[model samples]
Target: MQPEQLMLFEIAPDFRDHKKYRDGIFKTKAQLKEELRQLGRDRIYHVLSFGGGTQSAHLLEQHLQGLIHYDYIIFSDTGAEPQFIHEQVTWWQHRQRACGNTTPFLITHHSSMERGLEEMLMRYIHTDYQRFQMPVYCSTLDPVTGEIKAAGMMPRQCTVDFKIIPVKQAARRAVMELNGLEYRQQMPENIGFIIDIGFSYDEIRRINTSQSPQFKYMRLAYPLAEENLSTADSIRFLEDNGFPTRRSRCYLCPFNCDGARDIGMDWDEIIEAEPLSFLKACWFDTELRRVQRSGSKIMRSIPYLHYSRRPLVEVFAAEYARISAAYRVELAEWVSSWEAAIQEKWNQDELLIRA
Candidate 1:
């Protein structure tokens, strides 16, 4: 019998490590199934999915066959991510179509992320950052002293305004408009939505902290958390099967791997070489924010000179220069190293199935 409650399941193994909890790998699949069965699939009115890797795709497939027909899959593109991810996503779409499933892509302009930051920056500049300021808020504190550090917050409206806000609006729109084929039925006042998040055991902090009143009362399911697999294993399994080696990489993201030792080393070099090409050209330069996050030299805000009238492109010398002026030396190094690490992970050889 089709379970009564609407079931929302996040289809990905734990992202911390490749291993699954409950003592072994691949245990996530079984664990997730049992959890969904008990979670009362009737109330599960909607399924929310974010593609992170091949395993995430697999998770959606599993649910499609057993759980319920998908209402919609909101594919949020940030204009920054591995080139191969686009292809893999296309294949996923095709395969779904072959099986008679309708998946819609929620495309957006590059300004989605950029504009939000610009707005945030404007707000900070207007308020002189006082209203938005926090003590040791953005500064890397001495774990013990918790000193009044130097590094301050830069605009990071990407996650909230750009990604999260747009996603929620799109999902709501999908349910009401009936514009897409995924909405097979009329919209319900309480169109039950269960946002399936692929958070592993280690990412529990992010998962728990992801709560918000805007999305309150709605279902936020965690099938992967129930399964307990780490992110590392998921990537390995996906690669071994001709799926791909890369994760759900975002393009021009400073967080991507860019080191020579990581999995997809070559792509990292290409991206890093043309630093001017970063999506967030503002953050591309020295790694001030990264360093500030860690304990190190702080990124200072002059408050006066830092105020800008010209476009970001012409305002700063480079991504690093802006960061250096904003933050201190240690923070800069951390940011630099971190970007490198992220870029190295997804390489050219990383297979992307785009059928």
Candidate 2:
């Protein structure tokens, strides 16, 4: 294999032979039906956690076509998505209006960090905040020998922190408002919720559980998985209808592959669509390791956003130089603005503590 073709973190040779990876634990359609029966579908609130991406778009289209039902459609913005993803989201909202879909389409973000993942990264870079949420690739360095060995990637907690949990919180608050109760009030036991996720049949292994850990009355269901649909199926459906098919993801997501992978989520796509965001991603990639190496945080393993375990700027050296030259002023302005915003937030918190 060529150098670029090599994956930094490859699965073990015997990975598929392991019981955890080989054994399937997904629920059958009949089991899903029984679970819904127990929750009483007539009384339960149905929510589509619309990701503004291919798979979720398929589910949303079904809702628009009256094939499925949803009381609420929620999109959680991570604040680091490329502008094209946001445009696709707006395009869907316009489609919803065209279809006369009355179901409420709502946008939400993390409760504390309203700006979402970008806020988290900026805070980590500029402050003493230590909770790192991204699933960055990690490596361990031998101090004396100066040799580096690939450590495992960090846990992917950002999805739960900035996306899934925010959607749940927003849905909970919306239901509370509908019931004419305070947001902090406990939800009524009889009013259950079934939140539909968009994981496809091919991604069945991603399914961990049917129950929400935070809310007893809330259960997660995968409609696409239940229908045995693959991601390609959803993409084809969108293409046949002349809909937007760009995959949605954070600008700096480690899952993004090089163009050779042909997996749709590519770094080249980000570079082409939004140069500034690409530069921001490079900045985060470089700064994360710099911070980790500073010996201040609890995490000891060195972190890298790029899957190749190299600096993003180094991976795309020529493109980085070109984009940096082109967007230097704009990038500076963005950094300045975010720095001011974060400082203001910290000052407000300090005042509150004093009070």
Which candidate ranks first by lDDT, i.e. highest? 2
Model 2 lDDT on a 0 to 1 scale: 0.84
lDDT of 1: 0.45
Candidate 2: the clashing residue pairs are none
How accurate locally, in lDDT, is each candidate?
0.45, 0.84
* lDDT at 109, model 2: 95
Give the alpha carbon lDDT tens digit for every residue of 1-355 in model 2.
5554344212222323323335534454345546756765436788999888999999999999999999999999999888998999999999999999889999999999999999998887777777899999999999999999999899989988898899999999999999999999988766877888898876766677677899877778887877767789899999999999999789999989995666889999999988999999998888788777777678899998888899999999999999999999998999889888888886444321111
Off by over 4 Å in 1: 1-43, 52-55, 64-69, 103-105, 108-157, 179-190, 209-212, 252-254, 257-283, 286-355
Write model 1 residue lDDT over 1-355, tens digit each, in one string: 2343213224443333332333333233334334444644333335555553554665666555655345667666655545567677777676667767665645443232343333333233222222221112233346688564545545534554455455565675665576353433544433345556566554544453323346542445556555565566566656665655456644433233324435442323433543433323344322223333333223443121122212233443465464445455554564455434333432233321111
Lowest lDDT block of 10, candidate 1: 302-311
